[model samples]
Target: MQGDQASVIGGAIEFIKEMQQLFHSLERKKKRRRSLSPTPSPKPPSLAAGELAAFCRSAAADVEAKISGSNVMLKTLSKRIPGQVVRIVAVLERQAFEILHLNISTVEDTVLYSFVIKIGLQCQLSVEELALEVQHSFSQESAF
Candidate 1:
């Protein structure tokens, strides 16, 4: 009887060890997956997107027009701000809007970035970050 009890205890220990190994493998796979994707999203307060965010609101108000079968409209224009060229795009829906700002410096030749704002919220009362995630998806998938 004592022998049987000892064997059961040994079996329990082995089972626990196997479970630990399985859990560790799962954790490693999860981490690896996270690492392979595009950029992680930045916090809104830290995004340096003040200009872009306001542009989204104004763009929403003054949308030139909407493209059929697609919600994206874009225009590239030289910046009034000296030495800057800007490409602007607006993605509009019933309650949400996404705007991409591609700013290029004519003289620097090295400074360029794209700021995307997704703020056409489905609910008027929805949180700001909720709209941000839609923009985040685009940035996460591509670097520019």
Candidate 2:
């Protein structure tokens, strides 16, 4: 009876050792997987846009008419700012009258993405004027 009991104890010890080996192997595999995984990167802000040339082409007739026509008011001319990334607050026309939040970059060249948001009605708004207004607004706000 004593011999049987000793053998049973030895078998239990062997089982425990096997379990420990398995646990260590699993831990190593987990570490390897983690090392192979890619680190996450911060994402840039994204905006949807129509191409400048394409938008111009689509709106060409209206643009030409406005340019040639003597009655074109600045308010009506305010909508044509190129490269203007607009987050629309409201849109009144397929080609005009949009309430938009403009994003203009000041960093220089394509690196900065220079364009400004403006509210426009009737004909398209002028890009240069909107940019000036936005810069002014930002300066004034910053000063205060």
Over 4 Å off, model 2:
37-144
Tens-digit lDDT track of model 1 for 26-128: 3543465568965442222222332222111221111112121222222211113222221123223333555543332221212222333344535352233
TM-scores of all models?
A: 0.26, 0.25
lDDT tens per residue, model 2, 59-107: 1111111111222111111223433322211222333533332232221
> TM-score for model 1?
0.26
Off by over 4 Å in 1: 37-144
Cα lDDT of candidate 2 equals: 0.31
Q: How many residue pairs clash in all the candidates, one count each?
A: 3, 10
Which numbered prediction scores highest in lDDT against the true structure? 1
RMSD of each: 21.1, 27.5
Error of 1 at 52 (Å): 62
Instruction: Work out how many backbone clashes candidate 2 has.
Output: 10
